[model samples]
Target: LSAGFDVADRCHLAPVGAAFLATTSSGVAAFDRNPGSSDATIVTSSMLPAYRGILLPLVYGPGTRSQRSATPPRLTHGPNETFIKAAGARSLAVLLDVLTRAGHVV
Candidate 1:
């Protein structure tokens, strides 16, 4: 598991192509499958901070079914601003393919 984030505003941005595992009226638990051979999980949980919002990262081991410290957020309405919703796991194959064929991140 990893650290937790608290949403502090309505203009927060969510990374695209990330998968969501849980959601509630106050927060959300989003994650992206590791793009590596180890297959570790990269999870981000955002909660409604009393007034603003925040984002944090949490990492989990590979092949685990249940998440321990990596819990979901309590989100009510859909993300107020930009949000990331990934459909598939990110693997080394995908990263290498993109890096080799698509050009570097600028």
Candidate 2:
């Protein structure tokens, strides 16, 4: 149960050949601000060699405040619920793909 920031930091120190799947809502709202513009939430890090890192941005409802607020709102319900499930499914798929590429059967 690591925070997004923590996971991001640790990614730098992860062993070679390590695989990671992490989700975070941070910066998502800002990135999705433009109307009629949508980008894939799933991203892979290319800077980290020998590491397979997947980052899934969890979308929040419109008008949601920044996570840096003094009292950040909980995101376990409402429209976020859907995003959470989607992130989980994507994460699982990415994990399976990583394992398969490593010569492991799922």
Candidate 3:
């Protein structure tokens, strides 16, 4: 809904205060590249129970081209944002599909 969070840096995002939202891979890919090795995905299962069932974990398959990590990292600070990252093309495609199914993309 928002173009981008009003933060000093691209890394800074809005506080998650109970909002229904999902993100695409292209966005997280750029962030991962910018930070040069950061957790591509951050989930707060404890805080948001809905997230547990709603989110589809982005797994790095054989063709995934983005940076890979042993375990996806979680957000350290405030703001309940989820970052799902993987191969830009496939990940983004999945995001589009999810958004389409969610009736966000017309």
Estimate TM-scores for all models.
0.18, 0.28, 0.27
lDDT of candidate 1 at residue 2, scale 0 to 100 = 26
Clashing pairs in 3: 16-80
Alpha-carbon lDDT of model 3: 0.35
Give the better candidate number (2 or 3) by lDDT: 3
Assess candidate 2 and give its lDDT: 0.34
Candidate 2 RMSD to the real structure: 12.9
Candidate closest to the true structure, highest lDDT: 3
Clashes of 1: 22
On TM-score, the stronger of 2 and 3 is 2
lDDT of 3 by residue, 9-73 (tens): 42223222111123434343222212322232343223366654333333332224322342453
Candidate 1 TM-score to native? 0.18
Q: lDDT of each structure? A: 0.30, 0.34, 0.35
